[model samples]
Target: MLNFKQPQLRDVIEAPADIAQVRTNLARLYQQKRQLLTDKAHWAHNDAALFEAGASYTRLFMDKMWEAFNEDKLIGDSALIEHLWLQVVQQEHGTAVNVNYADEAGENHVLFAIDQALHVQAHLTAHELPVLADITDEAPDYLINEKMFPALLQIIKLLYAADLRFRSPKETILQPVNDLHFGVKFPDAKTFTATLKVSNNVAVPVKINVEIGHYDVRSFQVVDETGNDVTTIGKPHVSASGTFSWEAQHLPELTNQTLTLTVEAVAIDTLPCLDNLFVIASGNNILMRTGEQVGSFQLELPNKQELGITVNSQDETLTLHYPDADTQIYELAKTYSFFGEWLEATLKTAIIV
Candidate 1:
């Protein structure tokens, strides 16, 4: 109902009444022109002052819009004005305004717009704009119940997924070297000692994690240089497959520490059957035979002399001995074969000093 239209003049003034009407219209027009001029002068002065004061005029305009919207004096759609305010913020600052939904449906568009509007509201709140902040504090009940609640829930879930995928720890602090190997005489239980070394180059103390990959571990213990049982400080986890793993609570900085693993295990008879032997033979250049094929397989010694093979069967196992050392017992189907050459080559290749 607030009108700013200029009064119009009639061309033909027929009588004295027409003259009175003309005077009234002229007075009203004059008052309207004065008001416009005053407003223009006030705007020019304020604009210059604001520029000198280094104030953001766009934010000031947004605050005024919020005021007008609250007072029911705004002439246009409130939602459109809200969208424009957010767009202005997006242009001024680099904050992301829109969330791209996979489905571009009508509801999704509404949600996107609401997201942008809320971000602008948050921006106003962050900058401590008192007018908008106080007005927004009493948000319409419909907006809270219908619009913001669902959107906030979805945003929280998205943030949690992003945090877990990108921010969680992917690997342990200490990278373990592949150095767990045990040498044992066949048909006998032997205790072997191996050292695991880790270097800590950082300034602060770090926890050390030791992982042993070998599966024959019957009993395992970790000790430090002064023969202190370091595994007592941290929990040791052993898998069903006998993989020994431990994590220590403390390791000093810029130090190279060696942790000794004392493992007791039985050998020879504990070695797995043909499937594992095939894997071992495939890498060692040793040929295998099963099911009724028996022949003398000769192997050239490291001294370049050919050693003759004598296969003796006992308890479905073939035992072949070299001059001094007994070879590893290789389990086959219904028979076990011992290869002195393979054992000699494996002892040279497998054992880590």
Candidate 2:
């Protein structure tokens, strides 16, 4: 009998429809992603916004992949993953990605390596996106569907945590040693650079921490042994006081190299001395200015608001004063002189040696 049984109705009908549905879903997804990307094109000048837009596009793309792909197969095709990642990098101008996870409000957040983010922005501004491929991650290029995506998410989480630290404004302070001495370079009233050298005489290696006080300052840097920078450790914290601990190995011996940092002071609280007379403060240091003649004073602040100063201006003489918390009046200087016993003594102690 050469005759064959007829095909089952379920198999003949369901399979073609399922394949068509998958193709339809993918096509719709591709179109929606293209539209989202078109909207993102306008956000080139803004980082956070551009990142958000790119994140939305990534979520759409990933959702389509999940819907169209078989869970038992490799997650994303290598060529397709690279193509999409590169597309996002070129269109959004960075390596930021959305891993399709929701936050407390059920919002998808964008993830990025901040160093890469900064580099991408620089390259985009310079019109040179081609060179960025060398630095970007191809991890997604290796991920397998369902089986490897979880691991990939975990890896991205680590990168996210690191990026948070990298972008934070908190200074890292490692093992504190009393043997450290700072050479401060004062450029102006509120600007200074400090070089810290630790004594190598210690029998054991000591760790040191870096502290960043004012976040509104111009900039900061931490240089390493080979003249390379390790300032990523000095990101500013939201609070006025934050610290980061460093391993002993991270710190170079004092004889080999010293730690250097630059800080620009922003005036926070000011105390009026007299008419046109005021004391401006940057961190714990105060600058008392009397008509172009300025004297620097160090006021150790347990809290910024606890300290107060008053100036009593008199004819042919000006007096610099500070009132302690107990309301006792202390004269900082009685007279203005280019070189006076009181002024010289105060400067010698007030200025960082």
Candidate 3:
């Protein structure tokens, strides 16, 4: 999800009572709009009396609601209110409405500019009362005009949108991370490195937690590109279950750079032996022995690299050759029953670096 700061405005409706009233009015207007849209078929069939009655009711209701909004001063400053109203109207109605005013110096000043995300850039200027007068005079006609129902709906939606911006609870957003693969030798510990880039748009700093599965994390550290210890930026803690969590403050927003996470973890080695089938690993090689001879076994690496197994039918020994090493001979004592048991044990015991 994209993260960006929400637009800010002054004297926004903040009081609980004012917000409650605004919400009530918004709901009423929404219901009215829904009814109007629902009766579109009847209106289109030239039900003149029905259309006139609906239009009159909507106009009177909206005019009374607008008067109430002004009397309650839900949003202080007439110019600011008009600016927000026109901005939303323009956006939702797909038509730009003139919300700007010319100053004494003959310079046109925008009351507010709304972008695609409804982000507002507001500028206080003169001639606000005239703009408000224009809106008030033309609003009743707009409400009665059947073609302008969407604009009326936008007015209601804008009120709720602004209310949410000011009164809604803050939320912390987190992006999902891809799956991680850790490679470690059996009965041995290996350190693996993963990189994460943090992008935050909220005002407060956030704590990040990375979870690792199927391994026990021994140590974890965070470093910058220059190998400087930036872990002091936050208190880093590693749970016994292999979760590394840390909070960083005042980190620079990056478009491309990323922080490095170095973790030292050991693979779990409690794989149970079944039916004389046993998996043994020494150095960088894992050897599986079976009582019956098998032609071959296919092994897949965490990196999607496939490893070919070399079978020694004489001893019923299957050897997995790592790409980084040559095939080595191992002396086997007991043979296993099937390759499936060995494969399961190898998967459980294997860790990618």
Candidate 4:
């Protein structure tokens, strides 16, 4: 832990510490935010930088926290940091972060205490009130409403309904989800990027196909770091759903070249625009997000073969299952929507260097 002090708005901008220090300060601010609750002051808009500063700090903090959590640095209770945030702000769940809306009476309102923290921070930092406890910068804690709540529900319903309505007779093939899952050995691996070891016990030389299909691609280009298109078929042949396809064969025995696809979302000002992005290679499937790369899955396929898996992002937690796998319930990001500004993916064949 680093020595952290409550910062004035100027201190946050001018005397910036390393990000760890910033995180410490931000945590301290959260601990001290209870004072704001009692003051009941209206917000001031002048100290918007407070939001920006806090947002930057919180972003770094969350990243570090996630990294540590993923690496098992936190002994028993890995979710301590996340729990602490929810506890301090009195939120029931993580998604209960700062959310704003007007009440039925048409009065500006917030749905979470995190919002209250931002409100008080703005008011006190603008010098509207004497410094009340450490001014909390809750802007970073606020949840981004990438799309309206109902709109997201519709996407989920459409996908789920599509699965139910379009099931194939014998295999129960979910139209889109099954279309996303077919031909992959491990349909249940939950991850964004991974290297799958192909069993040397197999007889045939390993081969796999990678296909990404989406709607509303703002921009789509697959290339190398030097801006060269490394696709084998000249350029990836795209179909109706903005599909990009690639095939790799005889891996682990030869180090094949790599290819990448950079994608951007088409601008859609219309409300409730339903956009989609999905990638499948080997047995892995992942829903691509804006500014995210669906690449970097490096697997070695030699005499047998290796498969790299980039699993789908259905929600916060991933549950693995076969094609026949079914669950009574599932958890997914309530706010997640495929509509984003850009996406990218890279593919590499497994070969002994």
Give the TM-score of each candidate.
0.20, 0.20, 0.22, 0.18
Candidate 2: stretches off by over 4 Å: 1-192, 201-219, 224-256, 264-353
Worst 10 residues of 1 by lDDT: 168-177
TM-score of 2: 0.20
Pairs with steric clashes in candidate 1? 318-336
Tell me how far the alpha carbon of residue 91 in candidate 4 is from the true structure, in angstroms, after superposition: 4.5
State candidate 4's TM-score.
0.18
- Expressed as tens digits, the lDDT of each residue in 1-353 for candidate 2 is 00113233223223432323433343344345446656665643566665554444334333333333332133344322322222234344434322233334554333222222222221112111111121124323211233433333333223322222221101111101111122222222254455656456555443444543422243455665567776664443223353322334333344446766555443222322221122223322534332311222233333342222222111112222333211111111111211122233332323222
Pick by lDDT: which candidate is best? Answer: 3
- Candidate number that wins on TM-score, 2 or 3: 3
Models ranked on lDDT: 3, 1, 2, 4
What does the lDDT read for residue 171 in candidate 1?
16
Question: Model 1, 258-302: lDDT tens per residue?
Answer: 777676554332333333444555555555433222212344433
- Could you give candidate 3's per-residue lDDT for residues 1-353 as a string of tens digits? 10113121111223233433433443344345446656777544554443343343223323333444455433333433443332222233111222343434555554322222111321111222111112233333311232332332233334333432211001100000111122223335567676766656545554557765545555678876667777666776656555766666645643234678777665433213222233333222444332221233333433344344543322322345445321111101012113233443443543433
Task: State model 3's lDDT.
Answer: 0.37
| Tens-digit lDDT track of model 4 for 35-130 | 443354442232343344345444444444334333433312332222222112222211112223443355433322222222222100011111
Error of 1 at 130 (Å): 97
Ranking according to TM-score, highest score first: 3, 2, 1, 4
> Which regions in candidate 1 have their CA more than 4 angstroms from the true location?
1-187, 201-215, 237-243, 253-255, 268-353
Q: What lDDT does candidate 4 reach at residue 264?
A: 40
When summed lDDT is taken over every stretch of 10 residues in candidate 2, the lowest stretch is 169-178
